[model samples]
Every structure is written in structure tokens, then in C-alpha cells.
Target: MSKALRRTFVAATSLLALLAGASPALPTQGTFLAPIAEHHHDSSLMYGTSSNWSGYAATGGKFTSVSAEWVQPTVTCTKTDTWSAFWIGLDGDGSRTVEQIGTEADCSGGTPVYGSWYEMYPAYPAYFNNAVHPGDHFTASVTTTGNGVFNLTLRNVTRNWSRSIAKSLKSATLASAEVIAEAPSSSTGVLPLADFGTVGFTNAKVNGKSLGASNPSVIDMATKDGVTKATTSGITDGTAFSVTWKHS
Candidate 1:
């Protein structure tokens, strides 16, 4: 075989081998790098708002991958020491674990701090060495390469920095996939949410298809009582979408 064909054969065989193996043991806690341990507030509402999350989720099937492209929003911290994250991932919808990667646009001491990160939920998030700035175009993804194994990739297209991680988690069910903007959780509770103005996610896809083709669930973030935090624009051209922040 030619070199390229040989490599393809080896990769295909490896994937098949992995899928045929027994599932790995679940981790003690979800693995997402963050300042403190906090619950991820999620949503399934198609059109509305919430205090926690605003994005698209594809449910009702065993999803293998999720990805999105977005230009990082310029954040103005109306309040100090606030937090928010924009990310794409698999699981964490109806499952106990999440494999997610995204960026943070936060306020520290009333100043804006921008950075990138990846998490396997319940675990604190880990930051990337690459510098992040407002208006940087980013592309991120989470893929389940096989049973209990995942790959997370994040790229700062504007800055030309990228990171990829692969690991195994037996607890992951690959039940759902998402692209979201959130008020990060903390040990005390959900942290103070930052005022991130507006965030737009474009070219969203699931299992290598446009979001619309996957029949995704539209979610609007809100408080526990259903007070809207942010509103999502309907998917355009089957792939592009936007989220407008309302209250912090």
C-alpha cells in the first residue's frame, strides 16, 4: 500500500478495535478545569432565555462529534469578578459527564480577561498558553473516537494557536452534544455571571453535518425559575447562529 493508504488502514483498524472493547470505568468526578467546583446549568428550551445557558443541543441520538466557529466577543465587565464561558462539547446534556472545550471572556477586578480552555465536566478547567483577545476567530470540537474515548480540539484561528487532547472516560454516554455560552459554576454556587454583550456561533455542525441537518434542540439560558438570560437567533443557512445577552 502507499504511505497514505497504509496510514488510513491503520487508523481505521485502530478505531474498530477501540469500539469493540469494553467501556472504561467512569471517573470519580467530571473533568473540567475551573476556578472551583460548580454545577453546569443547562437548557433544552427551543426559543426563550435563561440565566445559565444559550446554545444548540442535538439530542435523541448517540452523537459522536460536535463543533462550532465563533469570533470571541469583547466583554465589558459591568461587575467585577464575574465569569462566563462559550464552548462546544459532547455529553453533559442528559449524561453525568461532559467533554467540552471553549474560551472564557471574564472580568477580574473590573478588567477583561480572555483565555481558552478544555474540560471533562466536574473537573476544573485547564487554560491554554496561547493569548486570547476579543474578536479572535475560534474553532473548537469534541469527538468520541470510540467507546469511552474522546478527543477535544480548540484553535484560535485568528492567532494561529491550537491545542488537542485525547483521553478515555468510561462514564461518558455520548447521549447529547452542545454549543453554549454559560455562567460558570463554583464551589459556592454558580459564580457571578459576566456581562458579555453578545456572542455569535457560526458554522455549527454535529457528526460532520450542519446543525439543522442534525435536528438540534434550541436552548435559551435562564434562572432556575425560568427567567431568560440570553436569547438565541434561529439557525441561518443550517449552520450559522447567534446569542444575544440580556441580563447578567
Candidate 2:
């Protein structure tokens, strides 16, 4: 071939090779970063309202009253690309009391069991101060997982309340709010289940979210917006409850 023809052929081949390298690669299955799962629960009878309780246990002591509220969303994902956060709203009557508001990744085993959980004390006086009371409002967040589950549980433990007090309290009412993200786990790469649950209180309502049984990639206890605390009051019990996972 002539020198000019040879040069043109070489240039064409080089351009083709460059194009091949520059082309975007196809996204692999399970390789894409899924959106953070979101869920919310709200009270149907009352707008942001719930029941309460007070009690005592052999281990804790001096139990008073306990109330709670929560929300669960309907989104699913294997893991989050970013960190997860939770938000909540709280209120009550009587003296300013300390409330323990927390989120857990795996709670299928029950409370105080330490089954891969993350928690936060949103009350005004820290656990160290030991001075929290009713009518308190605050927000909390938990990024760590107990074992590696994507489950989130919000429990409002009173400073002086135990399982006994949780049972005797009357005229108890309260509200709980929550939010979560699709953030990646620090301990492991897998995300926790999106299912969630709450203890104490009556007439609970979960809003701004949906169920996860229909989604294949999403897990239970995964919330995105955290909890909200508005129009809440009263108390009934101190028992623990949860939104159990149902995979089809």
C-alpha cells in the first residue's frame, strides 16, 4: 500500500481502539448503588399520638412511666452507599424525665438482648446527669449495627422506670417519630433489615413509608426519615413491640 494509505489505515485502527476503551462499561447485576430504604408509621386514630406505661424489673429498679410511637417505610436495598441516620419527636406530662430513644439493626431476638442494635438517649439530661422527665422533645441518630442486621428499633426507656412501672401506669399516651438512610454499614458491607418495632404506648401510627415484603432487594427495619414527635401524650404499658419481617 502507498505511504499515505498506510498512515490512514493506522490512524483508523488507533481511533477504533480509543473508542473501545472510552466506552462506558455496562452496570453489573447487584453492582449498582441502591437508594436508601425509607419507611414511616403514624397513629390512625390520633395524629402523632400513642399510649404509655410505667413499671419495674428485677434488674433495672425504680420504674416510673413509659410511652412510645414510631413509623416504618416501604423501601428495600442490600446496602447503602452513604451513612444512615434517624430522627424522632417526643413529648409528655409531669416532671422533665429522661427518655432512651434508640434504633437497632437486628431486634428479632427481643429487647435488652443486645442482638446487633444501635441506640441513642435523646432526653435533655444525658444518662450520666440522671435528670430527665416528661414533656421532653428531642432527635437521635445511630450509625453502628449490633451484629450486621439492617433492623431499626426505637425504645423509650425512662430513667426511673422498669417493667413493673411500665405495667401499672394509667392514662398514658405518647407519640414517636423516626427516619433512616441507606448508608453503608461500618462493621460489614451488607445492610440491615428494614423492619422496625416499638415498645409501650397504644394506638400507634406509621406514616410516610411502605412495606418491604414485595421488594426483593430491600431489607426490613430500614427507615429513611427518622421519627417525628408531634401531638403525643399519655401512657399504658412498658412492654416491647416490633414490626416483624414477612418475606414472601
Candidate 3:
């Protein structure tokens, strides 16, 4: 298979696992941090009305799984002048839930990057969050662990874009990145539980012959599940999750 095809396959398979409530174990080679809540002051900047949530399962004090994916679009003026952007959200509603706090960005002069995370909270209504920033070339992941109201964690990854731009591009790079919510945070924030809801993505792409114009889809709660597992797909490749929560 071609490189693009391979990437699509891998991304799709990974997203499937997340939606099924079955997440793989973390890598032991790389150092990892315990899950923590990362809150953002700018919540309204990413808010919208057309958002939906999915992948709800029950986990009693044990670790439940969630994941997201999406594709991002890159604008190329010259082979040497190019840029891209993508975003996603992490949220939940209840007395305590998981929330996304921040993200990291990575990129290449010509290629893309990846990002991921694992978040944890002590209360419900975590709020909508993203794993990456706009105009970045990166991919991300998230995970969480804990019991009832305590002992939750979050992990994140953000791909950074390069400053160099290829001059005289042969083809336009328009695509959707994948965003996954591997683990929900356990928090007491009001945003996670509000009626407004949350959103995420999996992939986005543009044809070499056509202009790319697509917006990232939102993920929100359809049914209230007590500590349920959910998944979001169809996002810009390399984008992560961000957050904007309201206190009610």
C-alpha cells in the first residue's frame, strides 16, 4: 500500500479499538507522566452547536477506554510556503469527569506529526477540550485511570509544524486528521456536564486538483452513562484535543 493509504489504515484501526472500549497498553520505553487535569481559560473560542458524542460503556472503578481521530488541512502557497490547523475536545457530564487541559504541536517541513493524551478528573462536567493547536502538523492520544472520585490521570501528545515551506508544490495537501479520547478525566468542572456538549474529529483531506474546505465535527453526549466509554473520529490527522469549560 502507498504511504497515505498505510496511514489511513493505521489511523482507522486505532480508532476502531478506541470506539470498542479496548485500548492498548502504554509503551514502556518512553517515560510517561501520571494523568492530571489541564484547564484552559479560553473555552468559548472552540465552542459550537453542532457536536455529538459516541462510544458509551460502563466501567466500575476499573479503567475504561476512549479514543478520537481526525485529519487536518494544509495550505501551500509555494513549495516553501505552507501551513495547517486542526482541533478536538475532551469532556464529560456528571458529578465528576475527565477534562483536557493543554496540548503540544509538532510538524515537519513537508510531512505531518502525531499527538495523544490521557486525562483524569475528580468530579463531573469536565468540559470540551482539544489535543492540539491550529496551524500545527501533529497527531495526539489520551488515556486515564482511577476509582470513583479520585486517582485519575491524563496523557497527551502534540505534533509541531516546521517553519520551512516547500516551494512549487506539485500537489495540494488537503486531508482530515484523527482525534481520539482514550480515557476520560474525572473532574468536578461544570463545562463537562452542561447541556451545550463537546466535540472531536478523525480525518480531513483535500484533492490535488480541488480546494479543501471542511470544518472539524463536534462530539457530544447523546445518552448519560455513569463512567461510560466514548469515541470520536473523522478529524485532521495530527491534531489534538483542546478545552473550554463553563462553571455552573
Candidate 4:
């Protein structure tokens, strides 16, 4: 096999080995990054609301690929630490695992912090070493061969940098695909959401078709007490939409 293909094969096999005996949260650079999904999500509410996620997710069918592009929103910070993420993935809408990658805007100790990360859910996210500032244009995608091998790719167009990881998840359900703006969680529960104003996403696609073609569910972030946090705009032209933040 050629060198590049050999590398991909090795990466895929290595991922299977990791997942076969995965830990709750793996240490990265001797530190654990918090997980992002709400484990107890009520998927029964397909077009329902979530406490931490706002965007579009298409379920009820097997998905092989998902992609979207967005401009990273800048966070307005306060004394409270808060976190927000924007991403595209193939699961975790109705299943346990999510293979996703995206950009992050956070308020760390009341200061603005920006970066990017990818997570194979059930494991802590592995952060990319590159810095991603606000306004960076990012295009990301997750694709699987419908058997196991998967590819996750992200590009910071404004920064002229890209990353692609070949991974394997033999037990992945591929239950759903989505592009989301989320309030990331810690060991406790959903953390405080950063004030990101708004993020615009375009060129959304699922399995090579426009995501709107799947009749995706539009989500709004809210609390069980009926407090709205962020809202998703209906997809326009089958490819574009926006999420506007409304709370902390």
C-alpha cells in the first residue's frame, strides 16, 4: 500500500483498539477536556428542544456523511466561565456515540478563549493545537463507509489550516446527523453557555445531499423551566441557516 493509505489504515485500526476498551475520559496533555453532549437527551421529542443544543439534526435514517460551514462566533465574556461549540456529526442525536469536530468560543475566568476540537463521544475531546479566533471561517465534515472506518475533517479557511483524522468505530449506530451550536457540559451537567451573539452556517449537507432534503428537525436551546437560550433559523435555499444566542 502507498504511504498515505498505509497511514490511514493504521489510524483506523488504532481507533478500534482505543474504542474496544475506551475510558470515560482520556487525559490529553495530562488534562481532561469536558464532554459536550447531554447523555440523557429526550430523543422522543424529535423536533423537541434541548438544554444545550440549537441547530438542525436529521434522524430516522442511517447517515453516512454530514458537512457544514460556519463563521466562528466571538464570545462576550463575564466573570462566569462559559462554553459554546459549533459542530457537525453523525450520531448522539439518538445514540450514544458522536464523531464530531468543530470550533469553540469560551469565557475562561472571564476572558475570551478560542480554539477547535474533535470528540469521539464517550471520550474526552482531543483539542487541535492551532488557535482559532473569532470570525475564522470553518468547514467541517464527518463521513463513514457504512461499515466502520470513518473520516473527520476540519478546515479553518480564514487561517489556511486543515486537519483530517482517520478513525474507526465498529459499533457506531450512525443514527443521526446534525450541525449544532451547543453549550458544552462537564462532569456535572450543561455548563454556562457563552454569549456568542450569532453564528451563520451554510452549505449543509447529509450523505452528499442538502441537509434540508432530509427534513431535519430545527432545535432551540432552552431549560426545562421554559427559559430560551438560543434559537435556530429555518434553513434557507436548502443549505443555509443561523443560530442566535439569547442567554448566558
Candidate 5:
């Protein structure tokens, strides 16, 4: 994370992005919107090759549940606007639907902002009124409660706050499970990524099995041409991993 290396990574990522016909990065602000597409443009940073995803994913199983724990990162708004989200979700690897819930840390007007929300793909995500801030401990889970019905839950261990929502998606394929730190999408495209320093996830599991037991893919945020967007640490002790900010 040195100044020279960071600058190199950013320049290379930006060049590759321009070559890929991507739009120039926008100045992101306000609350995250429910994505209009089933997949976000930032899926390039994901690790798996199952169509769409940039996070660790387990395929070939009827993934019943996925969970992970992370302490909020201290985000800094060195620039005017940027965005990032941390969440656990099911589907969206080989399916059109994604069931997800987590928190967002956004840099708006050079100020760090935080909040929590949930999304059932193809529908708009809803933000919860519960407070979220840097250093809060969070545990989030997405469960497939049979027949494409899902139960999503998120808890703030430091605040004794939690929220759960149950919804049904009859067409869900249950193809994959994911734990992700993302540059969330909006109507325009992928938003400018926030500088979240580094965030670590522990006790990551799918269907009650650790990530190693599930044999999921390890993902680093990069484009097809090999320019780094973010760097992900290899899975350690089956359950822990980290994603460090590289470039927006």
C-alpha cells in the first residue's frame, strides 16, 4: 500500500477500464440504490469464473446458507465521492437472482457515511434505520429456506441490533454462495469505489462448512487484462480472509 505502488495500480486499472469501454468513474454520493441488473459491473474484481461474481463462491451445491463476520473498516474520503459495501449473499453466480444484506460505507462530500440495507434481486433494496459506523462488529447471513424462499439476517454485535427479512423467489437457482466487499452498483453503472483501507472477514462459512471445506474460489479484484483493482489475501485457516483497497 505504498504511494508509488498504489499509483501504479490505479493507473493500470484505469487504463484497462478505459480499454474495456467502461464509462469514466462518476462521483458517487447518497444512499446505495437497488441495482437494476442482476449483476454489478464491478464483478470484475470477483474471484470465481461462474459467469458473474468476484468473490469467493462455492458451486455445484444447493447452498443452504452463507455467513461471515467482519468489523467495519475506517473509511477515508480522500476524494470527493466514493462507495463500498460489505455483504454475504446467495445466488448470482449462475442465477439471475441474488439475495443479499449488509452495510455500506460511503464517502459523500469528503465525509464518511455508513448505513445498512438488504436486497432481493430484480427488486429495489431497502435500507434499515439501524445505526452503523466504523469499528462496529457485524455478522450477516443469507439462508435459502427451501423452494427459493430466503431468510436474510444482519446483526451489529457491538450495538445489540439485528434485522431479518424473509422473501420468496421461485426461480432462484441456488447455484452459489458469496462473501463480498464491493463497489456497489447504481443506475448509472458501478460507482466510484471508496477507500476502505482494509477489511477482514472471519468465520466465513457456507452450509455450515468452512470455506476450505466448501472449496470455494479465492478472488482478487481485477479486470481480464490483469490490472489489480483490489487485492484479496488467500484464505487462511479455512475461514479468514482480507481485501485491501488497491484502486477505485
Candidate 6:
């Protein structure tokens, strides 16, 4: 094979090896350099508003699982840098810890980029070295063993690729289960929201039950000053809903 073709073959082999747990984690790249943790705008809520998150969360339980499906939304990028992530996880509502995995659509130097990642909060996310694009169908889940062990899985059905990782986080409180579309954060604070139009999430489940049956709290993303950024629709069919971006 030519050098370029050989390099392509090597990368494809490496990604397969990594996804199958045959290879160790690689260095971070693309727009996934920093930790992406939940940054709440309203700490307490009847139905809350967050600076970074817009989705449904089931609280007041020992939430052992959360799973959802979404099509990666295409981002409309400008010269401005922005970030958005869709994920399902446990904790980070009333607890300090979060075990999450999902995909991101971002803007860098006026171009749109897509990627997948999993993170045990307080640590940086480990990205999956596979191509992701707008309109790729994805299903992701984060589940715990009721002890400290977790299983984080993401599958891109459109591309026929999947990754599942086993992890442990003793500090996780199992306080809440959530499926969220968020403007991911940096050390400074919540980053700008990407113009992702709208993303529909389906088959939302918590602990094997439909999320709508869990009395999930609906969250809308807004600024500290009360400027709305994204709006979440009511759950339908006991399993589906959508989040629409409203502002940066």
C-alpha cells in the first residue's frame, strides 16, 4: 500500500483496537481537551434552569441507569467558539460526581466538528477516535452496579461503531439520573452554546422505566441574568423529547 493508504489502515486498526479494549487510551485532541462538568445556573428548582444544561432529570432516587438516543445535530458555526454535548449519566444534580458518555458538536475556527467522549467528572474526558458527523444516529447509556462500578456505552448506529468502557467512581452519590443537551464547560465557566437547531431524543429510560414515569425535572438552559439559551419540549410517548437552541 502507498504511505497514505497505509496510514489510513493503521488508524482504522488502532480505533478498532481501542474500542475493543485491546489498546490503551490515547492523548486528547480536537475540541475535547478539558473536563466537561455540569455547571448549574439555578442550583435548586421546582423545574430548574441551568446555564449549561437543557433536558430531563430524574431525581430523589438511587438512579442506577440512564439511556437515550439522538441524532447528532448539525452545528451552524460562526467565527465564535461554542460547544454542545448530548449525554446520559448519573449524579451531578445534587451530587458532586458524574459518570457520563456521549457526543459533542462544536465550533473551532469557524468550522464544525463532531466527536464522542466519556468522562468521570473531575477528570478530563477520554475521546473515542472515530469519525462522527451530523445526523449520525447514536444511543448512549450510563449505568452503575449499585456499588461504585459503572458501564458507559455509546453506539453510532449510522456508522456501525460502538464503544463501552467500565469505570469506577466511589465518590459518585447515585443521586440522580439525567439525559442532557448541554453547553459544555471549561475551567473558566460554561462555554457558548452552539447553534445546533434542534435535537430530538428518544427512548429515554431511567432504571429500566421510561423517564417520563420517573417524575423527571425539565431543565431549560439560560444565563444567570435569566436570558434563555435552549428550550426543552415535554416528553412524548413516555420516552421522547426534543431540545431547541435559542441563544448562544
Model 1 regions lying over 4 Å from their true place: 1-51
Tens-place lDDT digits, model 2, residues 1-248: 02211000000000000011111221111111111111122212111211111111010112222223433222332333211222222212121211223322222122111111122212111111122222222223211121212122333343332211111112212222222222222223323333322222223222222211111011122222322211112222322223333220
| Cα lDDT, all candidates | 0.68, 0.21, 0.24, 0.76, 0.69, 0.77
Worst 10 residues of 6 by lDDT: 6-15
Error of 2 at 187 (Å): 5.3
Q: What is the lDDT of residue 82 in candidate 6?
A: 79
TM-score, cand. 3? 0.24
Task: State every prediction's TM-score relative to the real structure.
Answer: 0.79, 0.21, 0.24, 0.84, 0.80, 0.85
Per-residue lDDT over 21-130 for candidate 4, one digit per residue giving the tens place of the 0 to 100 score? 22322222122234355433343444657777889888888999999999989889888878788999988866777789887777767777676778886655677767
**Best by the TM-score measure:** 6
Top-lDDT candidate index:
6
- Output the lDDT of residue 96, model 2: 22
| Model 1 Cα shift for residue 94 (angstroms) | 0.3
Model 2 earns a TM-score of 0.21
Per-residue error for 221 in candidate 1, Å, reads 1.6
Looking at candidate 2, what is the lDDT of residue 33? 17
Model 2: weakest 10-residue lDDT segment is 7-16
Q: Write the per-residue lDDT of candidate 5 for residues 184-231, one digit (tens) a residue.
A: 655445566788999999999999989778867665566445555666
Please give the range of 10 consecutive residues that has the lowest summed lDDT in model 1.
Answer: 7-16
Segments of candidate 6 deviating more than 4 angstroms: 1-29, 33-35, 39-44
Per-residue lDDT tens digits for candidate 1, residues 72-128, read 998776545777789998876666677888987777666776767777765545666
Residue pairs in clash, model 6? none
Order by lDDT, highest first? 6, 4, 5, 1, 3, 2
